[model samples]
Target: MVVTNIAFIPARGGSKRLPRKNILPFLGKPIIGHTVLAALQTQLFDRVVVSTEDTEIAAVVSQWDVEVDQRSHALAGDSVSVVEVCLDFLDRTYKNRLPDTMVVLYATAPLRRAEDIQSVMNLLDEDCHFAMAVSVCHWPVHQVLKNHGDHVVPVFPELIHSKRSQWDRYYLDNGSTYAVHVDAFQREKTFYGHRLKIHEMPRARSIDIDTVEDFEWARYQAERMLL
Candidate 1:
């Protein structure tokens, strides 16, 4: 089916890495504000809904110019997979009136720019299983090492002997944005199913907020961008 309307944004309340990081105050508003603003800026989807079980978070989202898909408590646990959250949100919010497309935007991705969102949306097609934002990292895979029991092994052993980083280039899942067809998600819960599309964004714009340090870094980056 051809895709037009999309609705989905996973923002659970609990976070072991950085407790309540999703609703944490950023520069002037909650962390999710940036994501909501970016989503609105794109003006691509018919409706943008934030999926969460927390009333406070839902209240904050209501303050924004978008709808809220108040999630169930069981689905809000840390153990819940993002795919599960997205599926549930879609089922409950739209019922049988599912959209042709569904895009899942993570609230932790504060640095995801409005332009990048628009760029990824442009890549969405009926044939595409999924499409997401990706960015190239400065580090080489050869530099990564892993501890294997008693021995430290090269994360990518083959890359250890590689001459140039360019020849062994790798892209990181920026976690900034994702757009998927509704039918594709029903078939495969993952964004990268059988046929996935890639939309590259600037590495600086893909800063996913996780810790206090990450928040500070995002602030610094945002300030820098403003200047």
Candidate 2:
């Protein structure tokens, strides 16, 4: 049987750190525009939808000729979770007809490539319920320090003097892409499931823009990549 895949991007209007972050221009178009275009380029999704409450964002998405899943004000707040937004979109748009796979792409992840999106989606198969894009930690985990009341202390005191090879490597979610089985996502209400896979991405492509500094860094990285 053939399986249908849908790409969902959630970009709410209100951003405290950076105003209109979703529509902030990266290279030539808005940041979300990059994600939408990347999703379209993948050719893996049957439909690419941007879920947002901002009319300006909707207008940007319209320029790409993709469907815009208008989010309700209730689910489009600062405290709202991305999972909630995905569920709302699924309910409103595909009540009767649910896709086999759902790819959740963050609008702020401008450095995300189409190949990375396809890689994560490909990991979501019969046994796997979710597949997320993650990047290996740049710094040594043993050297990480935590702030105490009076002074800073190593997070792992036992590994403070240990070699980097002695410590287990850590990986962090890059927030670039999340691929989940639609039915499994609806049942769990989360991307984390029993059979979840991780698609390791390089640090250069793991930039998730939240603040102005992050945006600037992402811009630099994006421009450098193009050159």
Instruction: Report the error of model 2 at residue 124, Å.
Output: 1.1
lDDT for 204 (candidate 2): 82
User: Which candidate gets the maximum lDDT versus the true structure?
Assistant: 2
At residue 223, candidate 1 shows an lDDT of: 88
- Model 1 residue 188 CA deviation (Å) reads 1.3
Give all TM-scores, in the order shown: 0.91, 0.91
Q: Model 2: runs farther than 4 Å from truth?
A: 1-3, 142-161
Cα error, candidate 2, residue 176 (Å): 0.6
lDDT of 2 by residue, 142-161 (tens): 87898899999989888789
Runs with alpha carbons beyond 4 Å of true place in candidate 1: 1-3
| Per-model lDDT | 0.80, 0.88
Query: Candidate 1: TM-score?
Result: 0.91
lDDT of 1 at 2: 37
What TM-score would you give candidate 2 relative to the actual structure? Answer: 0.91
Cα-based lDDT at residue 153, candidate 1: 85
